[model samples]
Target: MIRHAVLAATCAMALFAGAHDGLNRWTQDAVLPPLLHETSVEVRARGGELLRAFPVEDGRWRLATRIADVDPTYIEALLAYEDKRFFQHRGVDARALIRASWQALWNGRIVSGGSTLTMQVARLLENGRTGSWSGKLRQMQLALALEQRLSKEEILTLYLTHAPFGGNLEGVRAASYAYFGKGPKRLTPAQIALLVTLPQAPEARRPDRGARVAQAARDAALERLEEAGVFHSEATSAARRTAVSSSLKPFPATAFHTTERARLEQPEQAQILLTLDAGLQNRLESLAASHLNRLEPNVTIALMVADHTSGEILASVGSAAEIDDTARKAYIDMTRATRSPGSALKPLVYAMAFDLGLAHPETLIKDAPVRFGTYTPSNFDGQFRGEIKLREALQLSLNIPVVSLLERIGPERFMQRLERAGLQPQLQGSKAGLAVGLGGVGLSLHDLVTLYASFAQHGRAVTLSQYAPQPTSGQRVTASAAAWQVGEILSSAPLENAQLNHGIAFKTGTSYGYRDNWALGYDGRYVVGVWVGRADGTPMQQAFARSTAAPLLAQVFQYVAPQIAPLAPPPPETLIVSNAQLPQPLQRFETRDALKRADASRPDIVFPPSGARLAADPELPLILKLRGGTPPYAVFANGEIKALGLHSREASLGPMTQGFFELSVVDAEGRATRASIEIR
Candidate 1:
């Protein structure tokens, strides 16, 4: 009777296997070689390449990766759960199946599984689960054939190399990283056991969804590990108590997220090095955080920094919101957001005038109110200086002179110059007015920086980039002389006064009423532009660019300047001064070499005897009379050579002015300096 019962059980198993084979065929095609084996070599190769490529769609790559290429703990964790007895089994585990069947029979329901890893692979190759007899036969046939065609190690490798875990994820290698963000080889024991439990019902046991059944299954796997004497009591308890991971952000899957999206999918590719330096990124983020924290609720800040010469983004802080696991999108991208630049546009307007040969940094212009037709340009302070050099006008951020300069350059031509300087003008055409110079046209901080980059690069206009593929050259915006002039203005005026303390050149810009404040400049090297305030059109009271943004920029420069080489000024010969005849004040002082003992109240103004040329190399000791409050001056020859300001005298200026004596006087305040020289 025992023999008969044993034979009966064996026959029943055989019949069951046959029925399962038929069911499999009913659902999926039960071809001879199986889908994978029958696949073309090209298809297999393509699959391997696709797996290797791991293309990023939208913002998300098909899988997560690290610089190391693989994490071993993830592998161990997956193996621990998915196929603990994988090595011990051949194509099938008959004893385990019998025990599972007995349990099902006793429970009156199908509550267990006995399929080995190899059998699972057979099922996958044969396609969807089918309970028909033909399906069972085909699965068994494929399993036996695979066993003969490949060694046990090969079979295990194939199974591990090609199992599905999540969306479009195939193979343990892909699934381990796709879901856990690590490689199978880098998985910890707990992580491995967790992954092992996922294959039974991936959706039902998804670690990210906080599924209770999945947790229970994971606990069961831990128990099995404990039974195998592989885990200590503390480890088992820890695994049982561990909570499921909740972070599972879907990487963006769109074409616009990368340069690859810009091109059609292809086979061959090249590695691209970006201008986005990781260290600079970290540094900028730290700076941006301080600004972001101070912003009002619902307000956001957008900022970007670029290498002016190479057009690389040294740092980019797109928005104030912290990046979370849920999403990588920002509501406000200052890099692209466009708004009226207000006084920030002044530099470009001035640069255009410089390009036209219409103005120089020393060009004297009235900062007083100007009326062109019905339009009257007002100063920021609601008042103006009667006469001020172009540099002082910019340093004080005076509005009238910029309008005058813009008018001199013609509004239409000014717009064209902006475009030439790499600014993308949104205006369909020109609108003639004074308001234009006061930040009339809408522009982004990104555009402003690009325009400034032209000035920074000695008048070369280059396409700005956040990512650098390779070094590229930019078109020349203006002659090298004009370019040097622009750089000189930017280095000294608004930027100089703000960042000179830290050895940087920077400009500050604020939209009307502080809606947006931007500071962009370069110190003979990197170009950094910052935009302050919220995305929504809420106004910040007087959010001055220099007050709000330049300080932070100065801080960044201070930190980075030590690592960079110091920037030297252009040769003195590059500076051209016109309407530059020696002033009578300097000529008067030239005749009084012996009047060194004059009183501070008022020194006698004497004229040099007409054509009475002093020796080409004069040894006259000119007295520099200084009041308790007034400053002394150094003289220059031909406005290009610095005459020694003999510092040994009680006054700061010495007899160095004797060689074609030209008096250059700087006030004690150090804010204003006056120069006077006689033409030889």
Candidate 2:
């Protein structure tokens, strides 16, 4: 019995030693998670780290560099302030832990954190941001292993890459440039100190507070430096004396929100460079702000501008308000909302007619109301102008003639024209009733600009791009004939306001009253589209005049005109005409019916004599074109039922079915000559 008891004691001692050795091995072999991971834990950890890294709100990262770009001084400052005696301690920091435990016990609360930078990294690695003791134990175990596996520099780099500085910013590199607008290397002593203090309190040191907070931060940092002996007396004094700037230049708050949120949540790390011009974006925002303040309170505006030649978005204002975290998560997206495009669809109708060989710029059509298949389209004023040239119809934006033109072109072909112009319709090849000519098609502003830009570029369809690194997604649209016709209509638009000095070609569309009010047009260089209406279904009772969206476009044109070339000359086939050339009959008569009636009453026939004398002069009219004037079925003395046909080659008075006839002779002077004929 005594020997058995001794054996049990020996085995228990061996088991404890093996367990301790196994723990040591684990401590020596651990490393942080891979820089990139597909698991949810890694994604959340990486997202949190990125939010701590860049100038972002959600997932959109705009940073161009990484942690290595930060200054060594900032690194040292962070190390000294956040974790003093960091190098001397093993992974656990037993003394610091004991001190923290005693303090917690004495206060009956956890007042101070004993976890080092390594522990924080480990916490993120194993259990993320959970607050349980089980998680803490795992974090502590992982921290010791990380310290044993990686050198101090590697650990520092990982911390620099993962630390959240505020907003959507991650790491010291992004935080350094984002907050200070300079890289880590350029951070002043005060700036470095501010960064070190940020890991402790990001909200209190937000850069938007401008110089005042910046100064307060600098003062605190200088004092800390004085305590640490890292700064000279002069350095500390200069740093304290420096003024902090509280105001940052205002940026377009909306697009930035989108970009920031995308950086935070998007799985694809492929960087996004926006096509928005910072300066123009600010100007557009200012315009909307001024206009909305004067208008009703609920009105919101969305503006998008594109380079007609390249389809690159020069400026885009998604909304007047900033898109914050809640908005991003809820997907209250301003960019994707569908809006009605008012009279903006007219040019496409005319373009289709030209392609089908049915019309020209000078084609005449009555602007009077006509019924077709139970649909009647009316002009904006609900009145009719008896007869108008096609040019006049379009220039005045008359609705009836346009509707008639669309009918001649057919609905399917018209939709094909729109598709050819780079418009991705939500529904294609629908029955396009008369309303289509009046901007009846529900399209987005993005689609409107694309179709308009095709005309502006003389029919070359440049693909549209909202982000930078332009997308080559736009298929080459616009058949050559359609392109030529649309180009003419845009160039000849009449300007009601003289303040609009640029050669602007545009279309103004209003859907009913104010459900959607659009002014979409282009100069030789840029295509600008403005959509104004309520977020909910409501009408814009205002007309499309100088006071509304027109002036906004006028402003854009006036500013951007010098950058592009003058309006190109209209296509050669396009003709300019007036009411004088387009004559209207006292009463409308069908050309086919008029000819049929004339054929029945006058049936006198004439024929060239069997061996008639041919005139040597090609300009001279043929003699005996006809002789005996008689009734229907009567023939000339030459034995023909009809007079010699116009060219002296065929007889017109042959049968009731043959119809009436006349002769035309070409004179040497290039003039036309006619001959009289008689039937026997």
Candidate 3:
């Protein structure tokens, strides 16, 4: 009979080995692959640190894409509370299992679970459903299979990644953020004990919902840790005395728009890294919220801060609030909205003029009301400063002088320069006109910020980067000397009473009818752009750039001033001259007729000459130019006066139809010149 019993035990052992081998094969071939590739929700900031996280599905926040390396203290507490022999056992503790089985048999019910941490991880991976004895046996087999495939740390990572903490949270990191408003890397003893005990009965012991139950569970965990010598008796008592949090804290929501955009670009990626500074982003968001709360319900604000040298977008606030019922179109990202730029672009025009040697800082220019043919542009205050130095005109944002300079540079050429510099300004028509000098064209805040960043980088036009670091090599937009001159002049521009003296070279713009206000500033290391207006295009009464946008710009600069350096000195080629020491052409800006010769003859179409077959779609505008026309010529298309009193020798008859058309021009002396062109 004894021999028969020994033989039965040997056969049973053989059957158990065979079953274990089969389970290991099934886990390796069928289970581990999908479990290893589980999705994690992660967003990282500039330095590749966690910015925010969300759940993969059904509110299960599983940060399982990477191994979770938790704090040693939490790990010790977890082992002491969950399974004391976690490291020694392969997957299940034999002694504890036998003890639990005997107790269950004696009590006629299941008394306690003797599952190791690895067994718990296997159950979690299997959806944590052990409703029957057969299900529990299956979990035990899967746990043994996992032990053969993964290391102890790997198994622990799986547990930490999927352990239910409470409510919708399913990870230590998620639980820490929701309960403590922080990451799990650092936790108090009480917090660690609470997390250690949460996975067993997450809902029943949720601190936010049941503080007393959570505290009892946490104290039980602390008692286990003390008994196991992982924590001192006094320390465990103190931790047990700590009150559980009864309220859930909101997670970090800074850089919401930026994170959303990053996620969209890499939808399949579990971890996405962006070029954002969390501290700056938070401060700016707070600033925007505080300021916007005081403004009209329809008003909104968008701001961007970029590294001057690298063009990395540091802080990007798409709007004052991502969701606000009172704000019109609150979800719209205003930074990318195309709106009139107004005088914000004046610096680029002056920089171009200086690059072309058309004007100097000390050069005298008239700011009186000027007419480009019938189109008259007045100053913002409707009062002219008469004759002023070019620097003074730009600092004062005089409209007339800028218009005259734009006319001299040719609106087409000036716009081409801007386009070459990586700015896509939205023109009214297919062609550029003198009105573009005074924000007659539309450009997004992103384009404006990029253009100003070029000036800060000494004319090197680097494209702004939102997700990566930019290289130093970039397109040269203007002469270094020209950029230096513009930067120097703007650094001393007159500030409004509400503006702060941050020693920043800044420019302000107010779109037509106060529909948009912009302030763009730069130092040696950073460039910041701010826009304040109604998203629905409703005009605000007091939305001037100097008063509304500049102050905010200054406030942002102050927040980040400790991280920036002062502006550098001018380049060697920068010409610092007094009015009396200017060169001949630089002494005073010549008027249109002053630069013309007395013997200039009647005007004729120099371009699109008679019988010229122009392409149906030319990359450039359909330019119609005259050799010598008196000021204010009339351009007629098919005997219709398309444009009257054109001051410039050139007129752009936008894109023409694919048919034969007659283009006629009547000079100031009534001499009519005609040209015929065909579009193929």
Candidate 4:
């Protein structure tokens, strides 16, 4: 009946106008508009998980879509109700058009839409008016041109992409996510009905504005689907009873700082891929927000986790995301902010010493107060142990011994080493000093994590990045042996929770003014660094690393990596031995200048320097010589004190012992000097 009416209308048009030529020009006269439109920018994580999204121009949520991206069931129901003979028609369905024409003329009002999916897509593309003869005719012409220019799938995709849902919500995927908090790939029966009917009168039937109207429209769509047999009657009844959502869900904005930065840097990219793990990033962001309440009002927290082997950043929290307090400075990205590192740099200094053969794990060094001109470095607690091994010094983060070693390593060389490894440490002025190893130099959390990752990577620093995995040069920061030993020592350091051992070799640090506190750790494969302080660099008394950043670091590891990863094994060249078993020169770290310090009278072994070979004959006695301290002294041989209360500076010892022995001379002041010798 509708086809016969269209032919009758054509015959009437022939009487008024021309016959064949006028009909041929009818569907091809209108101009076509641009089909391609702008879409929302998406920031994705590894494996294509969306971390964040930005609206298109004019603040519209127009996410790009395809036919496959939507639920197939919804498409079938839509085609069945919108245009039953949709596939057979070129663009305009004559049957639906003639029926709609008669209904409007009979009722004197608009009822069912006569526009096919292709015609609706043409109207959307051209932003043309409907409910008028001229507008309807233009849509028919453009729809014909669109059908000739694009495939059926392409026309459907255009409808799906441009269909409006509500305020700022365009496209089926955006509508599904906004209304239902999920994608359109697999929608529920009720959800499918809602999506199928929303584009008809988006603003009038918006669920957020009025749920009753939206539900009515959705139920009507379900009833239509039941009448057409597109869905079972029972299923359609259940879908009609399902209530419409009254609220819209906000889209995910995970990894806020990183994703925002990525979009700003590459605005043209529709999908920016980062190296973050979405699950872990979201977990840490929530953790960061929850953990901030325990600190001072001005304090903020930041942490970063990375796969050291691949140089991929797994999670990075710049600041507390949920805080509304302005004093916390939550907008700042603390992971990239520059601050003092404190004792966190001690391990690197020890690694340098071990690599240069200046010290060993068992090499003894003094922790006593030492002055360089007017400057002096002491332990953080202001108390010091007179003599301790290098391993214990690093484990305890003893500032004095680390400063002593830094003096030998040359602070300039230390900074150069860090720079070569792709870390840019900021110094206060032009020169580097021994204090640089303490808290003199500035470093960001990124710099700290990258440098610490070198220890986990066998002394090779891999470049840390948030982009897709890229090849790295793997700059050698130190010998593998040194890194291994440093990691081993940190693994044994005491933790606040005695039972909390995750096989992570971690270290904590506090700056001089208690301004910046840090905890950095690494396992066999991953590295983590945590920072806690005010973003303004203000001092927070009692905010020590052990109490502040270390706890957070441990919690982060527990949440991200529940399974413990063993620390790296010692390298082949790592020296593992007791103090007495170490080589002579390495037995004690006594620089030439150390002997001339505040106490010039400190004991010194002037003869049999160290690693000396002497005759073992019974008649030839080895004379022990000393240059400093009081004349009275005590000499220890092997495990026994062989001489006591000897007033002479020279004493005859070791005549009968034929094997190697550790000899020590203790001055009257109790200060001692040790030497290792071999007997032939």
Give the higher-TM-score candidate: 2 or 3: 3
lDDT by residue for model 2 (534-638), tens: 667565566453356666766665555445456666566543444334222211211232334543433222334222223343344334332222221222322
lDDT of 1 by residue, 1-680 (tens): 23323332353387356676673453344244443331101101111222123333432223322323335444444445445566675565566566656666667665556566777778876564635545555665566566656786667655654455544555554556555654455665566676667667766677666557667877888887666665777888877777766566332211112223213332333333334554555566666766665655555556666777677655566664564312323444556778878777777766666666566666667666566668787887788788777777777788877877766567777677777777876653456455777887878777888887777777778677644433545676765666666666656653422333444556787888778888876776777777777666668865677767777766666555464333445645454654343232322111021233332323222333222244332454444333222334343334543433332223323344344444443333332233343333
State TM-scores per candidate.
0.62, 0.63, 0.82, 0.84
Error of 2 at 178 (Å): 10
Q: Encode model 3's per-residue lDDT on 533-623: one tens digit a residue.
A: 9888889986678888988887888787664467778888787878766644577886575456421756767677666677787455677
**Best model per TM-score:** 4
Q: What residue runs in model 3 are displaced by over 4 Å at the alpha carbon?
A: 1-33, 65-69, 105-112, 325-328, 494-502, 597-680
RMSD values for the candidates in order, in angstroms, are 12.8, 11.4, 12.1, 6.8
Query: Per-residue lDDT of 1-680 in model 4, one digit per residue for the tens?
Result: 34433443343343245465665576566668999888899988996777888999899999888888889988898898777777888887766766775766666565666679998999999889854556666777788788877888899999889998888999998998899987798987789888889888999999999999999999888888888887898898788778887989988777777888888888789989999999899888888788778887778888899999899999988887453457887778889999999988888999999999899989999999888767787677799898999888888888889888988889899999889777888887999988998878989999999999998898987899899776888778999999998898898876664345657789999997889989999888789999999988889978888988887787787777767688767777677988887666688897547755623576767667677777788878888887777757898888688799988778888575678888888888888888878888
Top model by lDDT, which number? 4
| lDDT measured at residue 154 in model 4 versus the true structure, 0 to 100 | 94
Query: Runs in model 4 with CA error above 4 Å?
Result: 1-31, 103-111, 233-241, 323-325, 496-500, 595-680
Q: Evaluate model 3: give its lDDT.
A: 0.79
**Model 1 misplaced regions, further than 4 Å:** 1-69, 80-127, 130-133, 136-187, 207-216, 219-290, 314-317, 322-332, 428-434, 466-473, 488-500, 533-539, 552-565, 568-573, 576-680
Candidates in descending TM-score order: 4, 3, 2, 1
